[model samples]
Target: MNRAFNRKRDKTWMHTPEALAKHYIPYNAKFLGNTEVEAPKGTEVVEDAVRKLKFQRHIKKSEGQKVPKVELQISIYGVKILDPKTKDVHHNCQLHRISFCADDKTDKRIFTFICKDSESNKHLCYVFDSEKCAEEITLTIGQAFDLAYKKFLESGGKDVETRKQIGTLQRRIQELETENSELKKQLQDFEEQLMMVHGSPAGSISIQTQSTDVFDMVPFSPVTPLVPTQANNASPPPPPTTLPPDISKDLFGAEPFDPFTCASADFPPDIQSKLDEMQEGFKMGLTLEGTIFSLDPLDERC
Candidate 1:
């Protein structure tokens, strides 16, 4: 019956629900101290509050039980970890004074941090089981101090003046950008005008594209026929043509009027006949070539 009762009691486990609960918020190490005492040196790394190599001392004491308590606290910057090394509660630690010591390779898993104590101003050393964790924590602390110092100024605050100068430069750059945009627009308008004036006559305006290849185009202009010009050293103009005997006034009638006003018996009748025939033919040719006939009046089909 006792064995059955013991089995039943063991089956009914306590704090099962508590063990399964999830802790989203981070917690600190349970304790940090020498491992000689039968107590926890620090909280488990899984419960670390900061995502860095950190530890916190936790003393587990029950009600009506007396146990010496260990005190631990972090300063404002959160880098200074306050853990007293001596009995007088002195020699606190700051992250800035800490460095990863390059000791001889004794153990690959273990590393040390040499830090200066705040109270005694003497260097204190601490060893860790994880070399990677030590290096990471040391690098983080060094970067933190660097960032803090870079942010610090004469006024014990942020460097606002440098920020203001940067803002001014940014505004100047924006103004320059606006000006550049305006310039580009003007250039585009000029290109369009050029296309209208010069490109249309040559051919369709082949606008240049954003490419490294080059295309050459000829400009166009209207051409006028050349006029003949007389050179300066040309010969003088020919004399005006002599006036022929006035025929329109009919000074000489159909009867020949000789300047001698006398008829010559020596003139041959055949020559006179030939001259009359030639005159008649010349007059007929003039009439045929110079005169226009109205063909419509003579057209019987009309």
Candidate 2:
């Protein structure tokens, strides 16, 4: 494993046990062939040929190969194979990437597990010779897997709760926006009604409208008089016995004159004769004044 990868992994929370065991990878089983070993019946024959070739390659690689020994350190973080004497790390796999772990069916002292390679992202088999502690190592790996899964579920639950809260807030915002729009519409209607009642727009007045400055000032007077005070309370004075002058008699005659009703036949003959004489005198006065003014102008010319 890369030193930088190990440093990054060290930053995470992990539980490390004191137990350590000798570990190695069988040359032949270090990595399984990438191709699928199983196929449908019709394709099985062709797949089988490919599988045999892969097995032969494994056998040839394993011949006379000497496996290097390392120390197996298992933890909640994953599996680490360290150089026993130098303490240098050779391989590291994360807990979540491990797919399988158990004791070999033929050898009880051999602990084996399949984990994905961090660098290549390929599943590789690790074999540990734990002697009498193989079962304990396998149990530790199982417990680590359980812990990792539980953490995953907890994080997922928190995400779901956060999403629900966000949705509720968004709905509340939409409701407020709808209410705000309705309030704006109501205000506009109120302004229009006010305009109709006051005979003006909401914020403006017509220039032709009369001002109420005098009415708004103090010392207002009532049209009717106030009640008399106790000291001044007395019976009103009686009207005078003398009658007012007859305006119609002075303008026309003793009877009230009606231009629409009175005709030439309605007048007595004697009063009609007097009216004709007054009309002739009025015409004679106008003619004498005109002659005097005309004689003066002629005298100036002479």
Candidate 3:
């Protein structure tokens, strides 16, 4: 039978009448501490009131930070199940996983459990202040144990898969090694063939020669010297002389027209008008300055 409810306030249990009678809520459900029950011995209390407090309650505040909170935690009858190493491993080899919302909108309480042996899997246990989380904790622990057990069964043995992978890798290595050995043998045979074909395997050979005149081999004492042909002798070239070129006429013919004295009428009408106006203004300004200096009454020296 499964336990299900909102562990915060809606504290309901999902179980048959027979299952509810058999399963008992412990008198002391406190984690890392002890508790006592005040109810009658056979009373049907759905839960124990003992709660798990924060680690800060036992810590001392030195300087600005809270120092380590120490506790004398004993697993009662088992080994030191509460490991100080801070790792998530629980009593069983399975991991200890817990989740909780610490906000004011939701009841801030944690629920946690671990997978026990298959014989004890029927009873899912948890520690939580909120009744909603407590019911959720029971169902979650049962599902976790079922899933973990299935995974454990699937990954139990290592012989078949491991051996197959090792055999495949070994075959591939052997194939590469065999191909390398065959190539080395072929290279050795080719080297031997080359040595047999070449005369000197270490170095090449050299052929030397000595020159001699052809007259020594023939009897040519009666032969006279032949007459020289016209092609045998060539005439010398004439000597070089320094001479100046005639300047009677220009080499480029007539000189080019002077661009400075060229007519401004060849330009566009607007450009010509601008140039003519500038020249006329200069002449008028010079005449006005000359007349002003000559006829000024303030110029006594003129």
lDDT of every model, 2 decimals: 0.32, 0.42, 0.29
Q: After superposition on all CA atoms, what RMSD does each candidate show versus the true structure?
A: 51.3, 50.8, 43.5
Error of 1 at 164 (Å): 28
> How big is the positional error of residue 161 in model 3, measured in Å on the Cα after superposition?
2.9
Q: After superposition, which runs of candidate 2 have C-alpha atoms over 4 Å from their true positions?
A: 1-65, 151-302
- List model 1 lDDT by residue over 1-302, tens digit each: 22212322243422222221221111121122321111111222112221122232222232433323233332212233323344343234443343223211343443333454445544444434443343333333333332322233222222233333444565675565566556656666765665565344544533333222234322232562122222334443332233333332232333322322232222245654433433322222110011211112132110
Worst 10 residues of 1 by lDDT: 286-295
Best-matching candidate per TM-score: 2
lDDT of 2 by residue, 125-169 (tens): 555555576655655555454444444345442233344445466
Question: Using lDDT as the measure, what is the rank order of every candidate, best first?
Answer: 2, 1, 3
Number of colliding residue pairs in model 2: 0
Clashing pairs in 3: 6-132, 7-130, 7-131, 7-132, 7-133, 8-132
Report the error of model 3 at residue 286, Å: 99
TM-score of each: 0.23, 0.34, 0.21
Q: How accurate locally is residue 131 in candidate 1, as Cα lDDT from 0 to 100? A: 32
Q: Which lDDT tens digits does candidate 3 get at residues 110-185? A: 3333222223323222233333343333343322322322332344321233334444665675565566556656
